[model samples]
Target: MDGVDLGIEPGCIFGLLGPNGAGKTTTLEMIEGLRRPDSGSITYGDHDLVRSPAVARERFGVQLQTSAFFELLRVDETIDLFASFYRHTLSTETLIERFELGEKRKAYVQNLSGGQRQRLAVAVALVNDPEVVFLDEPTAGLDPQARRNVWDSVRQLRAEGRTVVLTTHYMDEAEALCDQLAVMDHGRVLDEGQPQELIERRQPGAFIEVAAEVPITGDLRLPGLERVTHEGPKTVLMTQRLDETLGALAEWAKQEGVPLTGLATRTATLEDVFLQLTGRSLRD
Candidate 1:
């Protein structure tokens, strides 16, 4: 990543958001001292990462995208193994209970569910009792309920006064968790701010959504219309003047004999901000 500069605040959940191949993982790895950047400085307060990566390693806990543990090791044993590497560590029992892994404490690593494994990974990361935690796609693949469970854990981390640097492509995750956000695309930082601030600054207008079957074959001729695009089975019309756009849309629908099925209007979100900056959807 080039021209990337970010300052993560203490005791807040900071998110590095982008799609796959957008360099989110690379950025997180660099900060975690897993990969060194060719040039640029990484510092936590007075500690310089380039000159002293050990300091970062000692102070920051890491949960990689894929955490591999011995398949035969029990959950408690796995936590004990990771805790052995740190000078200062939390109690394994507390860690297991915090992550909601007490029921699977005796289960082998290979037998746990995907959500359980992910929780165990985060628990292992916290074994060091580090001040800052780096989580790379902490909730990548899981059911909705599992994803929400991880979210709760992350919030608890912030509540405990630990700085969390998380990378995720899920817009809802960013919106729900991040106190500060750095939107990245390709290999550069696009924008940085709080979730709502970035959305209002980057995509300040409202969006009008209609069904794709309405057959909009050409550019829409609505006042204050910024752009029109297709998202799955919906046609989205972004506009600065919501009243004028809605009036024009109603007239146009009546004139064209098109049914405005599933019509809705709402404020722009972080997903809209990402698309506005990169010209690509967050899921793409």
Candidate 2:
């Protein structure tokens, strides 16, 4: 992790996005004082974190990828146990309500569902009421509903004026939740900005996806077509002019006697940017 410089703004939900083994967790651990970099500066406001690591422990809240609690402990009891570690902490009752864990407060940690366990994990992180919260892969294994629940909790943290730094491999999660994002790979940051800003910078054109019995040939020329590639059963066309490209594409299909099946059009996304920069999918 050499020369990894970042400026995380106050009160913003900053995201660290990358694939597995990309060092997102290592970076977050360094910032959260769980692991120390051999040499680097981590400054929090006017304080230098490297010089005073204890300051980070007091001011930062952390939720790791797998948050484990005593299986026998009730939800409320788990929160209380973590609260006991901090001199200043939010009330356990408030933490439960904030994370929508009121109904599960009496349930043992082992009995809770995946979403419930995740909510409890977040509740524990907030027990310290720290100014900066770090979450690593907060929504990695949840279903859509559970993932949305986590996203809401994260936004609430930002609304309360706490700086939230999270790491995720999910592109849509990064797009919807992050106020600012850093795209990382191989222990380095490739780009950083708002989600849409990075998408526009890395992949400016719109995407046209079409499914055909016979894939389009490489030498085929279509108006406004910038690039063409295959993804599974679909041929993706990156186009500069949507209308011109669509019309020309339809005509070409008709001339070639090929049916354009499952045709779709949409703007570029963060996944596109990651692929462009790394030549690999985020899931890879």
lDDT of 2: 0.92
Question: What digit string (tens of lDDT, one per residue) describes model 2 on residues 109-191?
Answer: 99999989888988889999999999999998999999998999899999999999999999999999999999999999999
Backbone clashes in model 1: 0
Which sections of candidate 1 miss by over 4 Å?
Answer: 212-214, 217-220, 230-234, 255-259
Worst 10 residues of 2 by lDDT: 213-222
Model 1 scores a C-alpha lDDT of: 0.90
Clashing pairs in 1: none
User: How would you encode candidate 1's per-residue C-alpha lDDT over 231-269 as one tens digit per residue?
Assistant: 787888999999999999999888888877788999999
Each prediction's TM-score against the native?
A: 0.93, 0.95
